[model samples]
Target: MSENRIYLASKSPRRKELLQQVGIAYEVLLLRDAPPRGPDVTEIVLPGEKPQAYVARVTQEKADMAWKVIQLRGLPQRPVLAADTTVVLGEQILGKPANRDAAIAMLSQLAGQTHQVLTSIAVRSALGLHTVTQCSDVSFAAMNQAEIAAYCDTSEPYDKAGGYGIQGAAARYIANIRGSYSGIMGLPIFETCQLLEAAGVRTTTDRSL
Candidate 1:
């Protein structure tokens, strides 16, 4: 592994794009079930687990698992980065919609309301696990049933939290956002750079420095 390169333990193309946009060289570390037939990181929220805690825990588990994978495979040692994002409507955590109906329902609840998008990132390094969480408040414009249903019919909502993607067609429906937009997209560039730098992983900014 190059001194500047690290491992990204996420399947989200958005995360990859964000890392690339910031000139962070990373190889994707795909975590898959071996003989266990289960995921390394269970995304299920524990009983009464707060949204913040849930996201943070999941992200940490991912990074930890990625580190273990490196050791198991005898791969070069490097920082493993992972992240999880969720949408919160009050106390409820809105994960990825299961189907079109579910997507419609989630969008209906979010219409004409403000919700919080929480993204937690964790990196496992030789020192230990370093983590950070970014929360962004997003307000949605009022959407009628027809509009909601039409939007849900598209392919964007099913794969994203809160039944929508801020950078997709759903962007038009967003009234405002307060906080890191990249965080809402699943990776906050500023915070990610901080963690990576702290872990001694060089980025484009480091080259300029």
Candidate 2:
């Protein structure tokens, strides 16, 4: 792999778009053929696991899984990056809704309330493992049943944490946000680049001294 290219272990289109926005070259690592190692490797939330800790743990697991895939496939040893994002209201962690009704319920609860969006990123490379988390507070305006139903009908919330995508139709529902907008979208570009640089991956904007 070239110095400018890394391996992205996630299958999220949002994460890929974020990386492209920052001009970071990356190749998607194939994990379909990779052996199933025990559990899903990144989805279970242990009992009493703090939201922050859960996201961090999941991100690390993703990176570790990607590393194993690299070794198993004999792929070039480039930095492998993975991330996990979660929505939290107090101690409750809201992951991707399982269905339309669940998405509606999650969105209704978030209406006119302030919640935390935590995104944790982990990168594994020859330099070692580096991880960082970005927490952003998002406040939503009061939403009515009609609005919620209409939004959910768009079918955009099913695959996203907290049952809504900040960069999608849900943007109109946001009254305020305090923190990285990109983080709310899935990946925080600033923190991602920081970890990438620390892992010795070069970006297009990096200048060699």
- TM-score for candidate 1, please give it: 0.95
Model 2 spans with C-alpha error above 4 angstroms: 35-39, 204-209
Q: In candidate 1, which residue pairs get closer than 3 Å at backbone N, Cα or C atoms, i.e. clash? A: none
Angstrom error at residue 169, model 2: 0.6
Superposition error at 145 for model 2 (Å) = 0.3
lDDT of 2 by residue, 9-94 (tens): 88899999999988888899766654643225748889888999999999998888788788877778999999999999988999
The positional error of residue 59 in candidate 1, measured at the CA in angstroms, is 0.6
Shift of residue 43 alpha carbon in model 1, Å: 0.9
RMSD of 2: 1.7
- The C-alpha TM-scores of every prediction are 0.95, 0.94
Q: Looking at model 1, report the run of 10 residues with the lowest lDDT sum.
A: 31-40
Instruction: Give residue 109's lDDT in candidate 1 (0 to 100).
Output: 98
